[model samples]
Target: MTSILQVLIDAFALGSLYALSALAIGLVFGIMRLINFAQGDLITIGGYALIVPSSQMVAELFIGDWPWVAMVPAIVAICVAAALLTERIAFRPIRDADPATLLITSFAVSFFIQNLILLVYTGRPKAAGIFPGLSQSVTLAEGLTVPGIQLVTSAVAIVLLAGLAFFLKRTRTGTEMRAVAEDFTMARLLGVRSNRVIMLAFALAGALAGTVAVLLVAQTGVLDFRMGVFLAVYAFFATVLGGMNSLVGAAVGGYVVGGLSVVLQAFLPDDLRPYRDAFLFGIVILLLLWRPQGLVVGKAGRERV
Candidate 1:
């Protein structure tokens, strides 16, 4: 029982991280029919923003040295700025382009950010002592222990999810965003400012990415140029698994993916552990085959009469 409980806790924590990332991706996809692959780069930017740029392997804390109250908001702000800038410079001009074009543009932006980081920070990973105290383990029961970071991650996810729900349901801007997502053309005709709504979605997505970056760096204490890649990939899959058209589905999908990953890691033989992702994805493929539309089927896209 204890062992099972431990597994469940671990799964939930990891799932929370994936859920946050998936929500980020889902937000942008909801507003624009574009799959912003560069969302990962925004996360990477958030992590890198914490430390002073250096070619040396060890990263010196810059914004990271500030109190958490100030530090987190600063990182989020930086990512939001980056997201908005990308929208304005890279995406806005080509807003009416086909989905394929938008996807390619996102890839281009991702490569640009990655190479720029390599030029300034080098290819080596940097050790960052971000929120080192969170690494400590906390005892929950006689035989059960949980990492502080995991607990924090779960709590943060819950709060953010609830907060986002309220914002979307209660606020005028949020309503506008929802309308835009449902039918961009109709929404625009009905007085929704296209650029404003789209920019807000990207900004919100960036904030989520920034938050995930902090949680990830706190958990791993290492910064790599590719740190956000796996997270983004998994989140993207989660969005598809849950239902690309629904933000709620994205969140649910994140938890599902996270839970499956933990379960596989625990049950697989030691020798097979290295191939866990392969097996896990194989299972995901099977599941998708069973339910290609996703666990939650979103409403069909509206058509203009």
Candidate 2:
């Protein structure tokens, strides 16, 4: 029972990361119907923003040395600025383009960012001591030990999810966001400023990306150029699995995927352990075959304004 409980805790912590990433993806998709794959690069940017650009393995920690009070807001601001800039420069011009065009643009922008990082920082892994103090573990009842970082991850996830729910349900800007997500043209007709709503979505997603970056660096204590790739990929699957059109579906899907992946790893036989992801994805395939539309049904069709 203790082992099972431990598994559940691990699962939720892992799920929280996926859930946050998926929410970022789902937010922009809701507003623009564009899959901004470049979000991963945004995570990379967040990671790089911490230390000064250097080819040396032990890159100098710049802003990362600041107190959390200052570090977080600064990194978040950088990501937010990048997101808004991307929206204005890349997405706005192609607003009327077909989905395929937008997708290609996203890929282009992703590579652009990746290459830019390579130019600035070089393609080398660097050690990062992000919040080293979070490494401490806490003992709970029944002698169960929980990592402090995991606790922080879960807490942040729950708070953000609850706060997001409230923002979407209660605020005027939130209502505008929802209206834009449902039907862009109609929302604009209803007096919702399309640009503002879209910008807001981008900013929110940027903030999520920044948060993910911090959580990842804190957990791994390492920085690399491609760090955010798998995260973006997993989050994409989570969004699809949950139903791309619904934010709630995205979060639920992330949790389901996170939980199942951990279980598959924990319970699989020795030889098959290496193939845990393969097995988990095989199950995902089965799940998708059974419900291609998604675990939760979403918008029937997306129409352009």
When summed lDDT is taken over every stretch of 10 residues in candidate 2, the lowest stretch is 296-305
Q: Itemize residue pairs with steric clashes in candidate 2.
A: none
Writing each residue's lDDT as its tens digit, candidate 2 over 1-305 gives: 88898889989999999999999999999999999999998888888889985565446899999999999888888889999999999999999999999999999988999998877777878888788888898887686788889999999999999999999999999988988888888888888999999999999999999988898899998888889878899889999998888899899989988999889888999999999989988988899999887787655333320
Which one is best on lDDT?
1
lDDT by residue (1-305, candidate 1, tens digit) is: 88999999999999999999999999999899888888888999999999886465556778989999999999999999999999999999999999999999999999999998888888888877678888899999989999999999999999999999899989999999988888888999998999999999999999998999999999998889989888999999999999888889999999999999999999899999999999879988998999887887655332311
Runs of candidate 2 with Cα error greater than 4 angstroms are 54-58, 299-305
TM-score of each: 0.96, 0.95
lDDT of each: 0.91, 0.89
| TM-score, cand. 1 vs. native | 0.96
Each model's Cα RMSD: 1.9, 2.2
